[model samples]
Target: MRLLAFALLSLWACGCAPALSTFQPAHVADKGHVQAELGLDVSVPTGAIASVVDAGVVLANIAESRELTEGERLTLFEAGGALALNPPSVTPHIGVGYTALDRWELNLRYTGSALRLGTRYQLLKRAKHGVDLTAGAGVGRYVIDLPVGSILGLVELEDFTRWQIDLPIQIGTAGTWYRVWGGPRLMFTTFDTALVVDLPAFTGYPGERELASFSGTGLYVGGQAGVALGYKHVFLGFELTLAEIFSSGELAVLGERAVAVDLDSFIIYPSIGLMLEF
Candidate 1:
């Protein structure tokens, strides 16, 4: 039991955990086998953040002298300072995995500004019955650099960073040519960054300028559903994930020159991938 616990801890420390898409089956690859994957993930904003993104786009258009209907202008004002903030829309990743020992798979993946290393341990495998189960943990660091100039003004950020840790349990069935899996996950993420918003000088609407940094930590509970189809040595997969964040700290800038932007929101990540096994 102690050895198992130690192994799990070491895996978590490795920092590459399965993400929203676990294209692999719960069955670990044969010992010494290797797998390679390439995928794309797109984040679709929903709830409050979605509203802010829409309003921000409108504000950007107005800055470029694009006229808006009265309703659109209303939305821009309604979104408030939150509109000034921009989040990532799309990211792509490449992953490689190796089975160092029987029933254990270690993974390494790179997605833009982030790199992750993780491991999965197969707990149950019933090939005849087409059932399998596995669990894993992951930790990762990200450098988030979104140019403040493109958006409208008073937060200045240099080398903003985010940290994330997640735990996931996957269960699924696999046949000779296909696999299906879905499972639950818990993710904790934290970040520190600044924002820049500039109201048009021509409009003379004094854009709020507050020189402050934003920092917050939040927990997300979510699940993923995925399907994979493959030939002898290759597979194609797709996954859709939904998660709602519960915050531990208020997402805001510090000090008297403070800006408060709510970071609590619901989000969706959809991904597609091609995998090759050897």
Candidate 2:
């Protein structure tokens, strides 16, 4: 009985004893494996920043922020030429942008900014191949130029507000290190016009005669796709998207007579970007 107890104690000590973190052992499984990841994405100029941050916050919130926060994050996690994604994770993004005048009376020619927050949740927590999905939201703003032929003040220009929502469907490959993701975006926009010369605070037009005022709004839809290249300590990837915006608004100019102006336009823009995981 004493010999058996000694044998059991030795086995326990050997099995439970921890190894030095930097130490790597030779194994059929390769002594390298990643447990978590963080990614930064930039491509779409206007809303990229907000989108990335949103994704990252989500991943952090759900999975307890495994991303190295040491003020510097990792970009990829790889092993045997594949990625490492245990179950739950977070991804963040940021970007900048510029708009320009086009075929419409209401054209834009200015810079804008963006960001995002996102996260992934695993449905089957213990399986090597599981179903994980992600979601994020963000906001952006830009300045637009009007065809009224004046550029002196803010009144001659309009304000364009944009909102973003992202949803990603991710699936782990069968007994592999790669995961696939795809989703569509629902975007919203509002164009606000200002009164030139601060017309009486609430007066609708530039003059007391109340000739006309212009305004507009647009809605856009688009899709994006990407793959997560996971390494044991980092991740690397990229994505591309194409979006089309449709808008219409009313405009009026008056001195003594009343005339009506209608403005309509369609805008198409495409973007591409890269991401690093830490």
Candidate 3:
């Protein structure tokens, strides 16, 4: 079950990217105007995260301490054991932006179990041949639940709940119907888990032992590029973003004995959406 703890912590540490948001316009919308959008995002692992996910088959075999043929290991990993931490990655998101005053914009976005609120100020409007400049900040929070199965018949394994916060600063350009933006982002994450094990039954120890919680925080920096195309009030666009966890606090697990935590540090994604403005 120590392997189980390692797997779960790895999942939490690697899964820190905030759910995706669509690219925003550099210039605020016309006063009294509103824009609504719906999209799908796909997260692609990079750096250490990518390496670990790519070696899922080997990791699964190692955790189970089983002898597996190459084909068997590949099949097992694809069937969703340790691979559960990586694939089938897609989520839906929705966002809205409202123009409050001449150069001020208010926005809200939602993806999975996460929500975000933000504001943007147009620092420089686009001229006949000049790009627009804007700066904005946003805050987001996410909650995720992962279920681990029953163990030993003496106790049942429960779900792990992950909570996270994201703060981002964006600076970029806006065009009549297209925009490109990039910036820095910060994140904090914590998790709660209830692990009940009958120590006397297995380890010859006294009674039941439980591990209640774990947490970690990190700083990440990333950038994004996107373009929109449309006519009148309807538009379509795609965006690509890349981010890396540059530094992180250690993950601490509380139980009979604490477990060590090591996490991968990179995330990348692409998103596409449709928007209607009025």
Q: Once model 3 is optimally superposed onto the true structure by TM-score, how far is the C-alpha of residue 223 displaced, in angstroms?
A: 1.2
TM-score of 3: 0.66
The 10-residue segment with the lowest total lDDT in model 1:
9-18
- TM-scores for all candidates? 0.75, 0.37, 0.66
Candidate 3 per-residue C-alpha lDDT over 182-219 given as tens digits, one digit per residue, 9 for 90 to 100: 65545554443344332232233334343333234445
Best by TM-score: 1
Q: What number of backbone clashes does candidate 3 have, counting pairs of residues 3 or more apart or in separate chains?
A: 0
Q: Which stretches of candidate 2 lie over 4 Å from their true place?
A: 1-111, 114-129, 139-179, 194-214, 228-236, 252-270
Candidate 3, run of 10 with poorest lDDT: 76-85
On the 0 to 100 scale, the lDDT of residue 129 in model 1 is 52
- The lDDT values for all models are 0.60, 0.27, 0.53
Candidate closest to the true structure, highest lDDT: 1
Candidate 3 lDDT at 154 equals: 24
The 10 consecutive residues of candidate 2 with the worst lDDT sum are: 78-87
